[model samples]
Target: MRPTLTLIAASTLLLATACTTTPLPPQTIGQCNAEPASWAIGRAPDQNLIDDVLRDTGSRDVRVLEPGMAATMDYRADRVNIDVNDRGAITGIRCG
Candidate 1:
């Protein structure tokens, strides 16, 4: 009986795992025509950099996130996220 119970639990766990999926990358930012080079990926995200992104991407809601920071998982078609590293260099640009 114990062996049968273990088999049943293992099967249930396997089924649940198989049914789960990885979340897809945000598509809203991927669809934006904003040039990646325009944001200066290796530079600091200062006011001028922020202004450039706003002016170029035309996105009013821009979020600047430091490394390992927790950000909302919600998707915003009109929002842009700037990821910076420890040295304050821009690492990634994505749309929320």
Candidate 2:
């Protein structure tokens, strides 16, 4: 009986893990910009600038997983994640 309970617990854990949602899709600079009106957006900045945005924003959906360009100079959107290069320039922005 104990062995059966353990097996059931293990199976339950596995099923719970599988129910987790997938992470957000990595987007390109052009693709992110094309989406009109996001939840947030940062000003013209490189990828490193995103670190602060991610930390302060408190949203896992915001990730600069790839290199990309800032579509807007105002850094306005529903929710924006900026990716930049070594020179402190924005490569792309994603909105959610």
**Which lDDT values do the candidates have, in the order given?**
0.77, 0.51
Please provide, for model 2 over 32-63, each residue's C-alpha lDDT reduced to its tens digit, 9 standing for 90 to 100: 23234232243544445455555445434454
Give candidate 1 misplaced runs (Cα > 4 Å): 1-32, 36-39
Report the Cα lDDT for residue 6, model 2: 100
Instruction: Give me the overall lDDT of model 2.
Output: 0.51
Q: State the weakest 10-residue window (summed lDDT) of model 2.
A: 31-40
Instruction: Go through the candidates in order and give the C-alpha RMSD of each one to the true structure.
Output: 11.6, 13.4
- State the lDDT at 54 in candidate 2: 53
Reference-based lDDT, residue 81, model 1: 80
Clash pairs of candidate 1?
76-96
